[model samples]
Target: MKHVRLLILLSLAGPAAGAEGGPLVLTDLAGAYAPGSLPAGGGWLALECGPAGCALRSTRLQLSRKTVLHLDEFRVPLEIPRVKGSPLALLHGLALSPGPVTRWHGAGKDVDRVADQLRRRGRWTVPGDARQLALSWVRLPEQGGFRYHLGDGTTRQFLFATAFEGHYGGDTTPRVRWAGDLDGDGRADLLLSLPDDNCGFDDRLYLSSLAGPGQLVGLAARFAGRYPACGC
Candidate 1:
């Protein structure tokens, strides 16, 4: 059987009133894999997003024999009986909510070079006129952590290190889904899946805004949470 790629966009149901006085709409729908194409004994991938732009929520999902995948931040995989011929139904289920399906753009060797430079020197250099950015995991270190970088042509700064602090194992770094002009500032913003320390496996959506001199500042209301281990 030939593997199929499923690409679906979630429609936004309009901004609802959130308790935090910010628009309550979903964001960061990422790491989606087609049911038929999943690896045997499917594993879980990170789902990161939250209500407010400042707050972050981390979660995971397992691809096993189950129906009605719960759309939340903390639900674990349940061993429900399999329902045959319903794989495509999962896409429709997600369509009930409103949000943009996670899409990555401008991810290529150039981005990899930026990541490599960041890993080695904690900085990257790009042409001064480039815009937009995307990233992908190139390799995992022997110590068990992910390796990737972010850049398109213009931006060459390491935003992940500045957002959180603490030593993340080589395999535990967050996944980069997309990067573009998210805040209408003409500068690229990042949508990252950041791992939460409490769960140690699940991840949260981190939206980092570009600041003066190519620095990244976490847009949290209070900046409270377990900081990422520094010295990556």
Candidate 2:
């Protein structure tokens, strides 16, 4: 068997524990955290967004005057910092308000009708041989160069490329970092990471409440980063 490390941030088949029992919780490290509020053990999922890339880490929270993450290999940050004043995070397991995160993969073949409807003859495919689709990224001409949709491949009205419209250049290669309800609104929100630069991805958050008319999601937040490679 090929040894598979979790090279992607927040692996699709992630651990399921406290995810299903409640609405999604996005913790703000800059704010006050109550006692016993966060998950114990290595149960927290954090996405590190830098100008060059983004990395997903599952860690245990250590509260103090500062916040420290307990990771393997004695890894840690020199100082506690916040992204854009409030770094919202997926605190625990993968469950959202309505259901679970989509375990999307690039293993399934594209439906010809869906591709033709979207009109992007790119590498269109479903998520791991399933009938339902999780994401759609179509190629564009002479501009930001891409349009993204999140759905089961029927309606492309939910365009979400605005998150990267003015933020990236030269083919903003987007990938869904995690996909599910983020704000308890019953519509699927998204955490996306893409290597528009040569190194890593710039992360973006889209929520259902922020969606425009006839849309399912809209840009709520952004985390810009870059790294040495195009992966977690």
Candidate 3:
């Protein structure tokens, strides 16, 4: 198997941390992998941003004579073998305005609140065991949403769809982070941050369990009326 290296290049005007003390604002986010090694039909996945949000966009990829894949909003699972001297390479890039930093904080009472809302809204059902919860990030044209896999590891569900007021209705991007094990449930949890309708960011906490159902809670109330340092 051939190993691949990743290179990230980011250009910003100010320090990642602003004088006001907030998340580092990134003026430019761009990078490439195996720059000139990919085949002629291969190209880097570029980031597209507008009123909607930022997402990875790229043309289709011709993996082989019999394999052609479209890199659209839908997810395509592919398993590529390491062929010595192969010309295939992976690349990606992104750019965002300077703003407060966003990250996952972990599972907690707030996550439980979100989970309750999901149940009330008929979006999700509490699993029998908290330890069965699983979390992952997903992108879709209608709005970026998170994926929750039940303990069975095969059952999956969408948690929520986020859209900013002025952005394209279906182009919202979802940003999720792993927060390790929280709530002392012996299960892993997640943290999500997405652009809200007001153009500000909304933060949510989620806890996954192996012995119980999953829980999601929102932390926006804690910063009521206060705009997140970062904007959509």
Candidate 4:
């Protein structure tokens, strides 16, 4: 029970919770893994498959420096492979040629609209061939006010953020820290910072290849950077 509880704490640890700062951790919003690296001199790899963190020696893949672990499991690879970890942001499936990055702090009267900002920039591309990724912040008129639709696009629009609540509504502000082809699908994949007054620091990864029947992209993973109020 103590081990299980310790694992849970590790998953949710943040600056406020006495967590020692290291590289930024990217996790499957729905998968199992841990945020730890092997000893400094290129040692064996271990994967904390569960909260218990019962790591089995898996096949090792050569890496240049410290990295986040990726393993097939004990039976498959003799060791787990690690990718260079980042304290700011990290995501899998991202191909070269990083996408254009944009930021919006958010507000009521300021109105330095994110939509207008991207439109003014004109072009945000990914990879050498450079395919244009559609980006928009569509506002639809509603009964009381306008509803917001924000996302990227290819043939169809891929929404990562939306707002129906009025000006006073408590909605998390969506900030796009980076955008690119993480899935290599020639469509835009986004890494967004969605922070709430109560929810703490939350980063999300969206991939075009994982989209369901109607979505242009689907949430593939997440990294909870910090949490001050404890998520219930």
Candidate 5:
């Protein structure tokens, strides 16, 4: 393990080719195997088939390391292999201004690092600023995306959508939501609204564990928010 860490540090010299083709100082860490929950929520994570583990990293080089763990019965053989590699951000980090990305080296290094990078890349607004940020994967108006709105100087705008090119009306948007303490833990929980038939979709409520500023620990669907007629 020590040797692997050394190699990772050594590879931090020049920009390495990212999974998306961008040049970055990639790390050299192997997948971590264990039984854990999905960052998106719901049942235990099944990683025995793919890479031993998965990680979420922002464009600015911030990373959320994933660890697997088991729940329920111990009879289930959950073995995660190291093969899928690292996950790349679908969209660029939102920043406040233009400058070199900030490299956060604190306890929440990964999350902080990503936030700092977004701020540096002019991809984000003030942490608490009531600003609307749109993040997308692939080309705009052609893919899915997320929205972050600094709400009423008190709440933050949280929305996730499958369609990237359009916005939602009212709060029916599949993604407009918030992260609160659903379980009474200090950490925040995810609460998203599902779409309705008008949007050509069924509405529902989704929940997830917020690991950090923008990292989801695990995800699950709680209730049905929309019910449409069949064969519409």
Candidate 6:
């Protein structure tokens, strides 16, 4: 079967409310995608909008069509927003990797000590056939997001962190879990809980954003159920 990568723009019912009467709608805009071409197994869908009004109405980016025979990687030349005043060029396609694991402490030790200790306890193993590991930390009564440290236990490292969107901060320790290949080369994704929320629906999944061994995307989507028992 020949796989064709399609771009679908879907809009919820009702007229898209915008400054104007209706929002600019963009539907089934097919880009230069090789039909029957398989996309990167662990890749992501990149949404691009031109410099103008835009809205999606029941459209889907059918990347599955690009995967015909054997599974492969999907690389789409998506034109995304450059800097405030930079020339626009085709940015590399979005790639997907395993997620990150999170960990919180109860002893209330300092963050520096916790990170260092986790680094010391970092485990290295080649699962399946991939290489790379990331270490992230979540400190309570302070920040909500984790600091992502990329690279092996050796040297030369890259580090970054994703803080909460707004002032809503953390007051308690967040129990973290690792999601990735257990015996392979995939990274571990994470599922976290935010008990501080009074409403009880603070659980969320941090999806992989960047296409690398270690790089955590912001809150993918909220998880089901309200906040469960604090500990995990």
Instruction: Estimate the TM-score of every prediction.
Output: 0.30, 0.38, 0.29, 0.39, 0.25, 0.26
Stretches off by above 4 angstroms in model 1 are 1-105, 108-111, 126-177, 194-216, 220-232
Candidate 3 lDDT over 11-125, as tens digits, reads 1111221232221111111211112212324233322333343233343333322122223222222212222221111122212222222222223354455544443442332
Clashes of each: 16, 13, 23, 10, 32, 29
Question: What tens digits encode model 1's per-residue C-alpha lDDT throughout 75-180?
Answer: 2222221322211111111111232223222233544554555455543332322453444334444534444455555554443332223343232344333343
Preferred candidate (TM-score higher): 2 or 4: 4
* Model 2: CA > 4 A from native: 1-134, 141-144, 151-155, 158-172, 199-201, 225-232
The residue-by-residue lDDT of candidate 6 on 1-232, one tens digit each, is 1234222111101111112221111111232222222222222222222344211112122343322222223332221111211111111122232232122211123333433454355422212223444444443346355444434455323343444432355433333322332112244433344334332323334434423443333344332221111111
Q: What is the C-alpha lDDT of each candidate?
A: 0.30, 0.42, 0.31, 0.39, 0.27, 0.29
Alpha-carbon lDDT of model 6: 0.29
For residues 84-114, write the lDDT of model 5, one tens digit per residue: 3332111121111222222111122433444
> For candidate 1, which ten residues in a row score worst on lDDT?
5-14
Ranking by TM-score: 4, 2, 1, 3, 6, 5
Query: Which of candidates 3 and 5 reaches a greater lDDT?
Result: 3
| Tens digits of per-residue lDDT for model 2, 1-232 | 1123333322321222123343233433443232233344455555444344333445465554333332322212222223332223544444223222333221113222433434345333443323354566665666545666666555455444532343434444454444544465555556554544434334456666777876656766553323211221
The residue-by-residue lDDT of candidate 4 on 90-110, one tens digit each, is 333223233323222222222
What TM-score does structure 4 among the candidates reach? 0.39
Candidate 5 TM-score versus the reference: 0.25
Candidate 6 segments whose C-alpha is farther than 4 A from its true place: 1-134, 138-171, 182-185, 207-219, 223-232
